[model samples]
Target: MGVLSGVKIIEMVGLGPGPFCGMLLADLGADVIAVERPAADAGNPRPWELCSRGKRSMVLDVKKPGAVETFLELIDGADALIEGMRPGVMERLGLGPEVCLARRPSLVYGRMTGWGQYGPLSQVAGHDANYVAVSGALWLATQSGQQPDAPPGLLGDVAGGALYLAIGLLAGILRARQDGQGQVVDAAMVDGSAHLLNFAISFLPDHYGGSFEKARPAALGMHWDRPYLCADGEWIVIQAVEPKFYAELIRRLGLDQDERFVNEQRNPAAWATLGDELSVLFKTKSRAEWTRLLEGTDTCFAPVLAPEEAAAHPHNIARDIYKTIDGVLQTAPAPRFSVTPSAELVSVPPRGAHTKDVLAELQINSKRTGDRGQATAVGSPG
Candidate 1:
């Protein structure tokens, strides 16, 4: 059993962050019931969809008769309902928070969206980049001010949207447990992405060397905190922020002979020159050579590894951070506990994979268009 073993969630199937939030809850052992559309790929569902991992699936096409009531029946037993629909889509379908909260007084209604429930742009369509751009987080992508770029959806979708929504649902659950009244949690990606800039915003004055114009380069270099290309074209990064760590870095690189670096480590004026010097110096050795020299020391150093490389790294292997299950390479469930630990790798259920079992467990008779008459599971529970 996990820490959240008794918690139950109704996950309305949608794109991106909604399913991700469900996966996180499921990883912590929530009894997540995914309400999906009719299985178009009923016979050939992908079992490796990581975002839907560790969840039971039940098909609920609301256009069909009595489906909405069936959905409400699931909500009655659930502690939370998470959906990544637009602002008013749930209400249009007659399954809004107001309706759900009436049926289940303590149900946490989590609404995930890029622009949130209100404001002018709430109804407007947007993806990760747009939300990050509007939220000022895209500016932090200052790779020396060369057009900010990041891995797609990592910032806005997963980090900002899904993560914040998960926290909001958890908080709302606690609140409902205290007072039998639930509320809507509007987790906006734009708001959460802006909140993510707190570290940069709070430290801007102390870090930018008293010059706002220097912030870009400061972000790029950040007191010797940057990636360097090695002789073999692979990369290694370092962030020796403190003077003593800087001492250790250069000492390892045999650059202790230089007074310009030794005496003037913290001066903002010297960073540009130091970065340039290191750029030249790092190219002289292979990334493997540098990793051997700097892997375990306190220089805050690491190689720029790809996902496959990261999964195989010694440290990651030692911690069991990544696992390959059913030919799928994915990270293990995280934030482990000493008392009630999270589960290991959880399998992704096929669409409507648990329909019969879940309905039987809830004691709700379900109807559908299928020849099976009763709500037979669409496919094997792969």
Candidate 2:
């Protein structure tokens, strides 16, 4: 049992953010029914594709006659509906917000997209990198003279798209429960990515002591705010931005007595020189040696561990941050609750694995139905 134990969500299975949003809701104990397309190939499904955990899968071909009616019947009893199609795709399929909300007035309709439903580029095809590039987040991630290297799908797709859609759906569900009315949550990746960059955009102008032209370098490329290489070719990140932390870092490196560094700690013109000097010094020790010296100190230091290393780290092990399911290692459900904890992981379902079971549960008899002779239930229950 979880906090959202009784909540029901109908998920229109698509790619990327939509599935992720459904995964999050299912993780929190929502009874999510994923409506997968009939005859669509999913290739070889992997257990480590942890997004599909804790959900039931059903096959429904919306293009088939009466299939939309069957889908709408599921929507009629749902608290929310999640979809990630292009602007008018759902409308064309007869499962748009207007149709679903008319059937179930309190349904939280969540629409996830790169450019939203009504933007100038709403129907344009794009992925995570394109969305982040347009959002100015990718630009902000670049160093002084380096090309902007946005992370692969984490920033824009998962963070901006899936997380924001989940939040919007939750908020809409709350509002609907109170007012008996629901509205569409148009979660645009471009909009959410821009929103995520708010802190950096607001912080740079007023707080950074350098020209706007050199802002990226001054802020991120500073000696005390970046990663350095170790003798073993591993990396460690140091972010001693505050005076006390910086002083501690200098002391640990035995550079506190250097007159040039002591005098130029606050000077923007000296950052590159200081960074070069620090780089040379950092390369003298292996990552483990530095970790032994400064891992738990206030120098604001952390080793840049790879994914495998992170899973085995002591802190992660203590917190149980990762779980191995069926020999597949993956992260645990996050933001735990004290009262109603998230349910344990279940096996990811094969396509249409629960079709007969779900239809039976929904009380729709497929024996005497429409064109395809499959289950079809139309309209809201009286």
Off by over 4 Å in 2: 39-48, 209-220, 368-382
Regions of candidate 1 where Cα sits further than 4 Å from its true position: 41-48, 209-213, 217-223, 368-382
Residue 306's lDDT within candidate 1 is 97
Report, for every candidate in turn, its global Cα lDDT versus the true structure.
0.80, 0.80
lDDT per residue, candidate 1, 204-255, as tens digits? 6787755444555345354477789999999998878888898899888888
Clash count for each candidate, listed in order shown? 0, 0
Error of 2 at 185 (Å): 0.9
Tell me the tens digit of each residue's lDDT in model 2 across 77-175: 899998888888888778888898899999999998988888688878889999999998777767767877877988888999999999999999999
| Candidate 1 clash figure, as a count | 0
Locate the minimum summed-lDDT window of 10 residues in model 2.
373-382
TM-score of each: 0.93, 0.91
